[model samples]
Target: MDKNIKVGMADYKVASGEEVLITLGLGSCVGVIIYDSSKKIAGMAHIMLPSSLEIKNNSNKMKFADTCIDLMMDELLKLKVSKTSLKAKIAGGAQMFSVSLNTESLNIGKRNVIAVKEKLKSLNIPIIAEDVLGNHGRTIKFDCNNQQLNIKSIGKGEHII
Candidate 1:
């Protein structure tokens, strides 16, 4: 374990060695995690919004769905993870904004899921699984050792990681 390594919100963390990175409190936010078990490399991102098209003068473009994937992909590549060997798993994207909208078009959670799907498709990275879209919040953890994903909510039961 690396004492210098830490986890936080609205951020993506990766571990190449034995270190494991995690994040939590994902409400209306999406957690996109990519892992390569062969290389013991894992990355997790907590995205708050669907697209950055709304963030005027956006300097932190990596915080958006489109760029976050790209950013994490680049980091993985830098770590020598093959694109074909990499797989994605996502969670959260809850409709917890408290504003009602048509689930088809106006829901930011759906939009985030759609954008993530499209971007991953464009990148040729297949998403293996996901637990997304709901009115409740979620907390996700990714295990680099086994490439397992864990998800928990306020009232839901704990899942494997």
Candidate 2:
């Protein structure tokens, strides 16, 4: 039987075989999914910021897009998953605040999505699916056995990608 492993905000988890990785409350944060189909390994990161470099003395590396991706890749490689076989799926990155004046800092959701995409591109990891950009929170479920990402939102029902 598959078990659900919860990944908290500003956190991540890696699982293989029958385990499923999940994360909740991804508002203005992104849930990044990296999976190796043949190895049946999956990883999920719920990132809160675009760059770790922008923040001084950052304690949690999992909270930033750049660092989170890097850390997740390290974990996946530790599991003996090939870098070339890695594929990505992204969710969340919502505009949770009503910004009267658009600013770079205020557009955190958009910034996170862009940063994640850029990081994946830099690593040569292809993004297979994405569910992003809106004014709502999200709960993500990643099934390692099937390599499917399911996204849930209030009033939006659920979607699989």
Estimate the TM-score of every prediction.
0.88, 0.96
Q: Say what the RMSD of model 2 is.
A: 1.2
Each model's total of backbone clashes = 0, 0
**lDDT for position 106 in model 1:** 58
Best by lDDT: 2
Best by TM-score: 2
Backbone clash tally (model 1): 0
Per-residue lDDT of 83 in model 1: 76
Determine which window of 10 residues in candidate 1 has minimal summed lDDT.
1-10
Instruction: State the RMSD for candidate 1.
Output: 2.2
Worst 10 residues of 2 by lDDT: 97-106
Tell me the whole-model lDDT of each prediction, alpha carbons only.
Answer: 0.77, 0.92
lDDT of 2 at 79: 92
- Model 2 residue 2 CA deviation (Å) reads 7.2
Candidate 1 TM-score, C-alpha based? 0.88
